[model samples]
Target: MATATTTAVFPLLLLFAAAVAVPSSPYLSPTTLFQNYQKMLTNFKIFIYTPAKPFTFQNPAASLFYSSLLNSPFLTQEPTEAHLFLIPFSPETSTRSLARLVRDLRINHPYWNRSLGADHFFVSPTGIDYSADRNALELKKNSVQISVFPVISGKFIPHKDITLPPVNLAARFISAVPENASTSSFLGYLKWDGKTESNFVEELRKDGDFLIDIERELLDPVENVKNSKFCLLFYAGDVAWMVEAMALGCVPVVIVDRPIQDLPLTDVLRWSDLGLLVAARGGAKRLKEVLNDVSEEKYNVMREMASAASKHLVWNEEPQPLDAFHMVIYQLWLRRHTIRYARRESF
Candidate 1:
């Protein structure tokens, strides 16, 4: 019995030794893994052309959108590289001229059609006049994805088939202060010139609630907001700024004219869902009630939820605008690859 046990243990030991000795494939090796990761990252080269200087939220949205794609398990880091190209918005370079330039590049560049193709995405928030007006819809039909966020209407002809993705508000990071807190009740800080029309301020004042407005102060609004239980967003400026306010632990009272219609992201984000949102017309009374009823326990719970949601705002996280952009690019790449493979096999 002792001899048999020894024999069994010997074989097991040998097997273990053999397993340890065998080298993993280069793809599995640590050095190889790092190299492949770097290689994968080089795949998608993003080229952004923005004439509106100083890298504003609109331009940064494109970068943030692509960065979000890194969260996907299917995304090989090499296949999603990005680059930015800036064009000047000048009187000499009219919007029509820029549009012509974009069209010319798509038609003239050979690789532009193959690798860059219509699937290669472009975002211009300023207007076609600032960049190139090459019809994004036409590019999308061909296989490139182009998104334009025009500051004004009637600048670019609307594409009948292509619908712009909804603008997402980072709702998860918002926190509401309980009524029992000794701090100020003000909800948000804004650069109010005393001339800018704010529906929130007007409504609150009408409801006999006083609002503290500190216009154009370089002072940190977060410090003021931290002491307050609530902050107010009168109009939609940049979704990022809204998210920033939420990060500081204040609940937002978003004031919108059409509560549901004007916003592009009404489907995924509801005012009630974030425990935020006040309609321009009938929200003042509702806002007061919500503020008054919030208890310490409930406020803490909402704060946690908002913090969890804020994680999605990070560039390399799922369910963001970048993931949508990656899906479009990958689909186009697979289609083209399949066609080429089929032709090769036939030949």
Candidate 2:
């Protein structure tokens, strides 16, 4: 008999047992024939739980998550029949609701404590400005957090946790702008308030005036985004325009230091293969040269890629193949094996 010295031993044993010896889940058993028949239809299901209000429009990101989940094909009311448990809550305080929900679940349900929340997940889109009180964000302690902008530092596992694309279709209706530029104009905030690097636009623009500067007040931001051949996208803040540009068949030139590893379908679809990626601070310095360097033919090819990827950006009520709705579910499906539960234990 050998002593198991590695952390991988337990997982490996569980995997082997699942392949050879695990029985049909007792938790899925029904009370009556009618209930049993209903359970038969529940396959590849997601159980939704919100200890607080499900529809909290004050939190735009959270409201979208609830809407998207409700419309998805995998959603179900039956707990035992679910493959994934979704804990949707109004994270106004960020932790109180989560703490109470977990406590309630632990008392009434055995699923959470079985895996210590690895099987459970929640989506809170507004993780920004959470630095004021880091102790309040309950996600750091347990569970996989699905957020638009996850706090990547601390114990937040970027690879394990889901980083959703920010959807801003509500700004669909036209609004006033300064004036649309003759050339393709950059549209969005350049000032780094708190989250990103300090203002560096003046330094980047010194090389050449290839990129047009259109004050957001002059023209419709949508028109500016659509009309542009190349949209100047920085990692600073307000990246909604990237998806907006893609939806309107405009190519995006992403200027950032690190690779965008947290994007949806990263395992299958490569970001660089679809859009332009310029290096860090130096890339910003030589921004004009980088844009000019792209051949007209390559630009067209990139636009085609953008058009193809745009379909996945838009979420529909009816989940379509590779669309935003299915894409999120697909990521969950890939992680299904990681969910550790003690036989849905005798609760």
Candidate 3:
């Protein structure tokens, strides 16, 4: 009996002896990426655990993912056939409760102990602050995390975690950029609170080049964005503007205080191809110089690219082909092979 058990476990241990290295190149050919996406749609399967007891209420934000997964083709009832196990935790779920839930999963299941959560995952709308609860964070360190605000190297581990795109229903009504540059009435536009003492905003105000609105002054802000060549987007704890600007066909000059990978589907799409990243190190004058340096031709190209890429940022009721839902799933599929025991396959 001992020899039989040893023989059975030895093969599984040998299979995970070496870890596969991910490709160094950040960008993959779209053709190859989409091909893998198709494969994932066909083959990838997810198992969402059914708790022994039903909760009193479902979180509004977390319910979006839960409902989508429940309706998705990837869901599986049989855990033995699943490639990933999802812990459907709301963003408001307490650290203590989360720890307890994970403990229960381990105690009641063989899968958690078998792989130590290498194939498990959870969705958090507001992203996790890994430093807040070190003990709780350590419990599921090996599991994949899907979030809206995943910060690379900080709260999120690239290649192991997925950055989910926030839902925006308004994207459906937005129009793409006109083929003619002459259609743009303004060089840039920004809706400022007029209170934040941002050096970038002040500099742009001093230059008198951009149409800056204080408060909700504009009759229709969306229309103004459509008429502008570029949108001055400042990331002040919110990412709604990024998708909004892109969807409206306005090339975004994303003014970020620090370097971050907040954009969704970054692994498959090159953000630099669509929008500009203006570092705060240079202040407003630097922003002016960067925007001014762009040729009319380059700006038009980027505007077109932004419009094309915005499709990946929109979340539909039913998951669409190459939309945000598929993008998140693709990211999860890629991470499935990140575990030491999982075999790496080329897309």
Candidate 4:
């Protein structure tokens, strides 16, 4: 009886051993196992590089803008970590030179290229203060992932490599100005001090019978423009001045020949949008037509739309710049990851 019991127990033990010996799945390769492990360990880290200490409104603005990436709802509940590196550089650095420096840093530093992925880089164009020569276009061309929160002058143009959408000031304009105001007319400040010149002013005065200049009781020069139908913005100014004009609820007649590349026109204005567009280099003849074509009804409708648009431009609120930065970073990250995965597959 003891021998028979031992035989039954031995068979049972053998069956258990057999089960343990069976592999998880013959189809599972070593490469697959390694990939799974790699995926588990890899967490892409974003590196933000600034030229100065993050103190001023510009730096905070940049921080707030980039912070949106971590706040994204689509990502998992697990927290992600990113690094910010502030390099103290002279405010006098030219944009062209900065672009070259960034390119050189990325190329020479093996850690930047090999240890960290391309998506890790976030190069800020402006430092603590605004720089005139900082070319965002050049940086976009050289860097793997470049994000610019430029306090753009009217002169900044988008290069082919830069994927940023036009920075729309329409919302800002609408928010700063009173939407309830019935008048669509604006007075443009085109003070001919030999520094700035506009052909539209001369043409409109001659062709459309529009008032060119008026003497007012106020001491300030801009005060006279308050009652005018529209102010012609032939050139771009410092961000503060532009914001002031928008705050005054004055409709800007943008007359720059190049496209309003910085304004997010598509987001704020449709193709049928009613704002007057005068060609900068095309002469005042087209501007006169645009001025004449606008009827009071059309003007009022545009003013209403423009007002509604302004409500969206709350400066303290989550700005469009934040959203724009997140978009470019995510896109580059995805592309980089896809390439990495493809390389692994080929092996």
Candidate 5:
């Protein structure tokens, strides 16, 4: 296990540094800012709009969302006294459906027309949050969007919009993989939507000495990652699989087409130390070289880092401080304080 390139010491040092350094930043990150408003979060006022169809509770994201908000310490049933208005809907919930809901609410409520939805927010539980729809466009410009998959560029104003964490594994959902799980396998979880090119997968297979497969079966993603040491992720910046990989003790090998502007829990976790990154230009050809450089000892250390970080990724019925649920709220809280949207002329 005495490898020259990698060791567990690096992660331990990085983790220690993050613990000390985050508190001393000149400007506070969302998680830091959340401390000032922690007390208010429980009483944080929110008025949830009634949709034409009830919000789905069957999906994990939907179910956990209901529990987080309704059980939120900041629950407020009254619209007038609320700090923000929440309209919760699933990924399949269309722009037209939402617009109609808002239109109906605006007709009945003073809030929507009051400021053209500046203080209001809605949840889009999809991988792509930006919309081409007219009403969705207006809200993008005027109101805050609490989204799991956020486009942080011209699509959505990062300061105004909330980038939510994906639904985390509940305590009940955690698979009991041992802490010292073997990682001899590398599983690339790819969507064959023309994104996972054939050439790329072929090149990886040729790179050899590793059991690399894009095999799909009737198994949970977490279970696959748990058995593997490395989980290959592509076009994953907009998704929460990275967090899931880390929590499951798999060092994620994230291949990106461009520079990563931001990531979940940036303030809390030092991701560079915990995983591998490959540029998309000839990225597959470079995968073996990248993982080879990381010694087994170093890989083990990274696994430890992921295990520690996993706790923060969990969702409990009663939300815990800095857990996934609180992280979503913290981002929302941070955005509310970070940006002050002007009234949209008149509602």
Candidate 6:
């Protein structure tokens, strides 16, 4: 069973990894990265702990990710051969329930005790926090957490914890702009709701460089994005907007003040190549300077890259080559070196 699973999975993953043209590090050759990725594909095995009842997710990102993982060839029923153990649960599942699940795994399975969850991982769009209640410290501290929001805090350790793109599985309302579509009216478009009101945000709203579409006034929100050269994104809780903006062929200008992170697929996709990142700390004046400074030649290059990178953010019904699902697997493969497995007694 493991042999069959291994054989079927490797080629798809290898193809996905090979298709990634951008190297995460300039020092590493593409051939070296591909070789490393091939090794991960051949050896990495995941053991998903069966839940007492099947999980039902309300969030599309969580639903698609969990379901796709179950059907993927990385799954192995044999615990002894597993490199990572996945604790499957819905995003709506309470922290208490999640902690209980971990406790059950610790008591029932010998694997959890081997490395104390150093090789374990879980996927949550909103993220799991056992720290607030002062519970499951081992799992919280040791296990790899894959979340859509990778905040710049102690809560989300970059490179240690993984980032998953918040994928909207629904069919796009506007897939592509028409060939004869009108030229962009504004340099950038921001969908604002006045929820997070600040001097900087308000200043940006009135700036001539951007077209601020107040949420209540939006007739066609997607169209606003399509008609703009750049789509402004401010991360509140969800990042589905980032994916949407990318799919619409709009270059994303991710704005975050401090706590939040805007980059997804840090290892797989070159974010700088696709879009511009503006730190909100500089306020509207600085932001305008940065956006205006972008040369016409540079903007064209980013627009082209954004179009190509858009497919990687979408969650297809069936996992496709170099899609979000395969990219997460690649990230996990990169972090596989952190796993310290204990020697087991032979039967």
Among all candidates shown, the one with the greatest TM-score: 3
What clash count goes with each model? 29, 8, 0, 16, 4, 0
The residue-by-residue lDDT of candidate 6 on 101-152, one tens digit each, is: 8788878889777777778888776665644432256666677888765443
lDDT: the better of candidates 1 and 3: 3
Better candidate by lDDT, 3 or 5: 3
Superposed by TM-score, candidate 2 places the C-alpha of residue 257 at a distance from the truth, in angstroms, of 3.3
Task: Return the candidate ranking by lDDT, descending.
Answer: 6, 3, 5, 2, 1, 4
Model 3 C-alpha lDDT per residue in residues 236-325, reported as the tens digit of each score: 534466677787778877777677675778777667767788876787777778887888877777776677667777777765566677
lDDT of 6 at 346: 11
lDDT agreement with native, every candidate: 0.40, 0.53, 0.67, 0.39, 0.57, 0.68
Tens digit per residue, CA lDDT, model 1, 1-347: 22333344454334323433333211113343233323323343433343443433345445444444334333332323332121223324444654555466557544343433333333344333323233333332333223322134333323211113323344333434223334655533443445434555566666534355546364655566565555666554433444445455555556555433322222122324344665656656766776677776666545443433333233323443212343233323323332111212211
TM per prediction: 0.47, 0.66, 0.81, 0.47, 0.67, 0.79
Candidate 6, superposed: residue stretches over 4 Å from native: 1-43, 90-100, 130-135, 150-154, 169-183, 198-201, 259-262, 339-347
- Deviation in angstroms for 188 in model 4? 6.1
lDDT of 2 by residue, 114-152 (tens): 666666777766442222222223334345667663234
| Model 2, total clashes | 8
The residue ranges of model 2 lying beyond 4 angstroms of the native Cα positions read 1-43, 50-61, 94-97, 128-142, 149-156, 170-199, 204-209, 212-215, 220-227, 293-298, 316-321, 339-347
Poorest stretch of ten by lDDT in candidate 3: 16-25
lDDT of 1: 0.40
In candidate 2, which residue pairs get closer than 3 Å at backbone N, Cα or C atoms, i.e. clash? 177-217, 177-218, 177-219, 178-217, 178-218, 178-219, 179-218, 179-219
**Which portions of model 5 miss their true places by more than 4 Å?**
1-34, 40-43, 57-59, 89-97, 103-108, 112-115, 127-135, 149-157, 163-195, 216-229, 236-244, 260-273, 292-304, 316-321, 338-347
Q: What order do candidates take by TM-score, descending? A: 3, 6, 5, 2, 4, 1
Give lDDT for model 6: 0.68
Candidate 4: list runs displaced more than 4 Å.
1-47, 50-91, 94-138, 142-194, 198-200, 203-226, 236-249, 264-274, 281-285, 311-347
Query: Could you tell which candidate, 1 or 4, scores higher by lDDT?
Result: 1
